[model samples]
Target: MARAHRREALLAAVLTGALTALALWRVQPGGSGYPVPETPEVCLRQFREAILQGDPERIRNLLSEEMHPHQDRLVREQQPRLTQTLSWVIVQTRQSGQSALVLVHEMHRDGWIYPVEYELLYREPAWQISRISYLPPEKASIAPGTHVREAPWGQELSAPPEPSRTEGPDPEDTP
Candidate 1:
């Protein structure tokens, strides 16, 4: 019975020690608890943080050279939330080998969630941002009483606002 008690105490002590180590790992100044952002998901987390803080330089660093031209575009798009306090959330992250797609949503102060997807590639040193795609608003379906006034791709025509019942009085009715 004494031998069994000693074995149990040893087992408990080992488990407690392991848990303690894990718990304190991240607290260490230079700990390896969380590795450097090597994976796409990890890189994306950093990118999202940069976006939330409006750190254009950080965001640019995360992007690939080919995406440098788009830096201004991204900064411009995020300008709306600069004035208001906003929170960003990563909805989902999908990765395969060196490529990944991270779905993010920025919650506006007015409670609107705008979804954006980040395409990433694991470059030599780390994963880099390839592109950021914003989801477009859903098109309205043509219902019995509904009207399809808006055109695709946000284009506006100068023709007219009113809906016409006949298209030039039909082709056969022309004299």
Candidate 2:
């Protein structure tokens, strides 16, 4: 029947279109575009989105080898806090030859700033977040006892905020 053939063709077209769309959606880079930006502004924007979404996959895509290994740990750290409504406003951004630092004023659902630093490293075509140091950090391995937290990105990402402090002269003060 001609009418039956037409209906079948229409159904097939619809199915094909749906499949194509779904594939595009799934394979799309960062769900924004493939190959996330290495620039400081885009890096911070994507970082905020990844944190808010708590999507580890998105976060991983943005990182290079320097920051990639700790994706799981970063995901675990961010997931619990993702439930809370929050916002990130960039306070400042500093970039050297291959590294960048973004000062983000994270705010609660009520819009009060939660002070923290988000560090980014540019690795050609992408910018990877290297550290997140909460201002006035409590004594911890990941966070310094001072008002500023500074450490190697790889070592700093995994430790808890209140990491145990070994009793001795602080390593940071040596220099």
Candidate 3:
């Protein structure tokens, strides 16, 4: 019984140490928990942080070279809202070649969620954001009363209708 107790205590100690180490690693800056933004998803997270922190320099650093001219405009558009933003959740990411689209939903403190998509291009050093577009909220299912299928709008062609009292109807009596 004493040997079993010692083994249990050793296992618990090892688990507790591992958990603490993982927590610390994630909290440390520049660590694997928050390493440099190499992919589109990570880059977008940095972009979100910069916008919420109101750091224009960081924002400019993350933009593509073509967007350099619009730095001032972009900086002016995003204001510091660290308190207003609860978190930015990444919904999906689509990547093809050097371009990527990251969909993110920004949860606000006011119970509103706004979706935004970021277009990023892979540059030499890292991924750079090229465009930002807002997306409409997705519906769970299509609304009722909406047409599910479509047909041609123009007049349809078919055989002409037969007369109700045709002169040829007398042929029936002959038959």
Candidate 4:
């Protein structure tokens, strides 16, 4: 009877150990989390590395099919330009739920800096890129006293003259 009881206790302990290990494994980052990054920082780091390395294949896999073509074109078109004229650096990442927006700074060869924003969408159990947009740098407008004359093929030449202020709002504004 004692021997049988000992055997039963050993079996129970083995079962409990197995169950605990299984639970722990399921709760691990990638095991349960879809497209887990190990950590959020890792995700952003990987993104920057992918860009600097010019690995479009890795980038493409991270985007939806609809978004893939656009990024592919961007890499194909911009990479040469990027290699020649700019260096990309990730400035920051803003993440909400599974989506993230990565802000990148492009340091131009001429010492100009431009900010570009990348919209990342996480879906289908993975993180995929959705859209990318360029944000132009701010510049001061011409001074009020500065002479600004329109030349041929300029804004004034291409567009018809606007009605005088006395004429009131345009037709499009009426709606």
Model 3 Cα shift for residue 49 (angstroms): 2.0
For model 4, the run of ten residues with the poorest summed lDDT: 26-35
Residues 33-139, candidate 1: write the lDDT tens digits.
33346777777777666776777666766788899898888767766553442656678999888889988766555545667788988876667889888885222
After superposition, candidate 3 runs with Cα above 4 Å error: 1-36, 80-83, 137-175
- Clash pairs, candidate 1, are none
Better of 1 and 3 by TM-score: 3
lDDT, candidate 2, at 85: 32
Ranking by lDDT: 3, 1, 2, 4
Candidate 4, residues 103-171, lDDT tens digits: the string is: 877666555566778777666455666777888853323322335572223444456778567677877
Winner by lDDT between candidate 3 and candidate 1: 3
> How much lDDT does each candidate structure score?
0.68, 0.66, 0.72, 0.62
| Worst-scoring 10-residue span by lDDT in model 3 | 26-35
Q: Kindly report the root-mean-square deviation of model 4 from the true structure over all alpha carbons.
A: 15.9
In candidate 3 the C-alpha lDDT for residue 2 amounts to: 100
What tens-digit string does per-residue lDDT give for candidate 3 at 1-99? 999999999999999999998766532121224444678988887876777677666777788879889877776665533355566688999999999
Q: What TM-score fits each model?
A: 0.51, 0.51, 0.53, 0.47
**Ranking of predictions according to TM-score:** 3, 2, 1, 4
lDDT of 2 by residue, 75-173 (tens): 776655444435556778888888888776655444345566777777655677777677742222332222445544564465557878999999999
lDDT computed for candidate 2: 0.66
